[model samples]
Target: MEVAVRVLPEGLEPIASIFEDLGTGGVLIEDPTLIARYKDEPGDTQVVSALISGQGDLPVVKGYLPVDERLPERLDNLKLLLDNLFLEQRPEISTSELPETNWATAWQAYYKPVAVGEKLVVKPSWEDYCSEDGRVVIELDPGMAFGSGTHATTTLCMQLLERHLKGGEVVIDVGTGSGILAAAAAKLGASKVMAVDNDPVAVRVARENMVLNNIQEVVKVFEGNLLQVVTGLADLIVANIIADVIINLTKDVPRVLVPGGKFIASGIIKDREKDVQRALKETGFTVLEVKREGEWAAIVSILGE
Candidate 1:
């Protein structure tokens, strides 16, 4: 069964939990207003318009379930939970049946070689690409992890990384999702790179990606929260996490950075740019440049000696 639920922003977590409890493979929350940004063809405008009908900015959360004998009971349970959660303005959910699919790998069909920077190309492990321009490639198999180097958050960090990295500098990637940034650092000429993440799944996928890129010798993956497991001086540190986290991260960044070392912070929404800037400055950093793509921003700064 396929289901799509329209709910307010605050309701996403609860509704997603209900869907997961019903044995949904994955939950996809989407804002139709933002869908236009990812569409490339002229005909896609109509599709975007169709999605925007009457939805406004309300997110549409989608999930899928297998057809089984217990499906009716699961559906009842989901509806019951939804009603108990929202009494005043209950959200509407739609459902339909879908043919059996190997959806886990099917999403990879949309994954293609993307040029994130001037010389950097993010390619999937299952895809083939010939680099006629001698561009650097970071082969990846993200699996359950998030970083595929295509999202604006990841791309912005990659662009800034390309601009600042000099040959043979030690690099650290905090909140390293799928190990994409660590691989990028190695490809961009960083001598030794440390990729850290608290999630074991991310650590495993990132390690697999490093091996896929043949960068294992240079990039080491570690499971840890933020920068807690990181020590010593780093020439550059890149974090592609949220604004509040980045703001909190400012406290420890300066101490870990070498004098004149650079820090690239992304995963910041446009509204939180000023807050991140203020925090970085208060931590004794001089903001060098801020780059914005779509609704996201990446800030590059250096700590005072």
Candidate 2:
């Protein structure tokens, strides 16, 4: 089953994250800027190419799910999630039976190389990128999960990581989707890292990305909820999850983070920034900085000011 949503380009990832949460096997983004760039003949790929062609400049986010007996229920849940996406009006949701081969065909056309922070460049494993000017490139194939580092939420967190991490600090990545942040922490010089995600599919994809980056030994990917599987204290904790989850995560952050350790909370929708800030402040964290990019914000704080 292929699920498609027409969304504003800036708001793409939030909707993508919902499909991810529902255990999508893969996501194929349709960026409107390249209508002329990709043209499929009227055939197997016609569904995808047609999807890409229309809509003028509006981008379409697509996710793949197995056409199983459980698909109807999953679709219902996905629709529910989409309906609550904090938008002024509900966006359109469309679905169809997609061929497995079309997944790669669409991915190649839209998933281009993206650079995050000063030196952290996220390139797809199939894409080629030359590392220069002190760039630290993390090769990844974020199948099904949302942490591709292209989204503003993930980008803000990566940029914050570059600024805050000095070296050799213990780190924790909550909701470690695709393990991108954990890979960033290791590449940025964390000594040891704990990467946890509640979703089994995300955990598997993250571990694969770790191996792709060859940081598996440095960053451990495990299946666990926000902080349940966390054992030891960490010098820094980065979470690129939503505002409600981030707000709920505040109570346990200080417990697992070392004294004065940095906490980077992202995946926050702009409207809920103050709500999250108040939650963090109530939990005794002093907000050090907040970085905003295209309708998303990341809050950087410490255990103790």
Candidate 3:
């Protein structure tokens, strides 16, 4: 069932927190006037719009829970559990309609081969990219998923993988948006590569891309949150999610990594690099190298002894 709760004026935060606590999916919109107000008071309670299923006759509670009900306490505990399940913010673009100008072809027009590192070249499935002597070429189709090798985050992670991944190693790619990293690992001769994501749409897209690259057999795709569905230690673990998620995954990540195994992380803006590094250190990971490009940062760390 879908239920929508719109908090007017300055209520986005509280409303968001409420839905987040309830484990209900929703959207938050900012009108022009509120956008201006947001600049002045960014912390103003969030305006939330929630979508609930209509079949269920669940009591619809609106507005903040009363202080005396002890409901807020329950919601707070739920929020703590959900903090690891949901993305902090929804995507900026949520529309269902695609532009009619044939974005697939248009995007393809601008798409070109990307050189990830000295030995690897990431090429669009439609284009032919000649690999230099001893270099490997990874062909991919961006599709609806996020990574396509153009973004600095993906490139940086690929570079890290190229340098760290030895042939026939087992690799796990958490939050494998487009399956690019998993596919690349297979191409680089990793015997077993598993790519997993919480989003079913991402999983579908990643599977399709895996087929496009003809590595579906080597790269298994699964749907689940983080390491919950992934078992056993890996020779390498790559997580190219945002800083917050990386921080959250620190403890679980080390448990899934072989002793002295490497963890490569990206999708971190430069500003949050230190926070991620600190989280890794606290979780028993030693930072081995950090690479920065413009405002983005990627870290290569090892599981501590």
Candidate 4:
């Protein structure tokens, strides 16, 4: 059987995280307008589906959804939470039994190799791709940790990381979803990398990914919120989280960073760019660069002595 939720495009990332927490690693993303006839059509609705099965009389439900009367209640709670977070759209969730087939590999068709910045190439673990002479390839199975290296927020961060990294520096990746940035820093020749996330599952997936890339020795993954668990001083710190989180992190930026250290902060909506920039400046950071793609913005800053 398959459980599906039709959510707003803005909710795609968080919805996937919810599915991951449910232990369903794979999600099939369906866009109604991205077809042969409506290739250029713009649509707001996106469907995220997860596959499930029952072994016998006892049913298996993923994540926090139990196999009892509370299922509907839990789903309703989830919907309410999402509505509050997204604020602009309501999730229309639906469930249906699917015909027995290869549900595991079906979602793989939608994933492909994505090249970010000048040196980074993010390839799904199942996909095969040859790296160019100067490219660093990261094999990933994100497991719904909110990053696939294709999102504009992530791309902007990677681009900034590539440009700012000068090798042999200590790097800190806050809210390290899937540990993409940490692994990239390790591969880019950072002497040490710390990847931290509040989600335990994301931390686990990130550790696995680091091992998959054979960079585990250089990158360490931990489960924590923001910079609370971070130790030592970082020469470079990169955070690809939301604007509010970024604003809050500014309070401790000077404590965790070295003199003249670089801070790469992304995942800000364009409307909130000025707010975040102001916070960074107030917290003793000088804004260096501002890059925008679509409605997202990534800012790079330097800590002042």
Per-candidate clashes come to 0, 0, 17, 1
TM-score of 3: 0.66
The local lDDT score (0 to 100) that residue 298 gets in candidate 4 is 96
Q: Which pairs, if any, clash in model 4? A: 22-63
Q: Which ten residues in a row have the lowest lDDT in candidate 1?
A: 32-41
Question: What are the lDDT scores of the predictions, listed in order?
Answer: 0.89, 0.88, 0.76, 0.81
lDDT of 1 by residue, 144-190 (tens): 89898889999998999899998899999999989999999999999
Q: Write the per-residue lDDT of candidate 2 for residues 89-145, one digit (tens) a residue.
A: 567788889787776457666888787868789999998789876789998988888
Q: After superposition, how far is residue 14 of candidate 3 from its true place, in Å?
A: 25
The best candidate in terms of lDDT? 1
- Which run of 10 residues does model 3 get worst, by summed lDDT? 48-57
What TM value does model 1 have? 0.73
Give the C-alpha miss distance for residue 233 in model 2, angstroms. Answer: 0.3
Q: TM-score, each model?
A: 0.73, 0.72, 0.66, 0.71
Candidate achieving the largest TM-score? 1
Task: Sort all candidates by TM-score, best to worst.
Answer: 1, 2, 4, 3
What's model 2's overall lDDT?
Answer: 0.88
Clashing pairs in 1: none
lDDT of 4 by residue, 190-239 (tens): 99999999999899999999999999889999888899998899999999
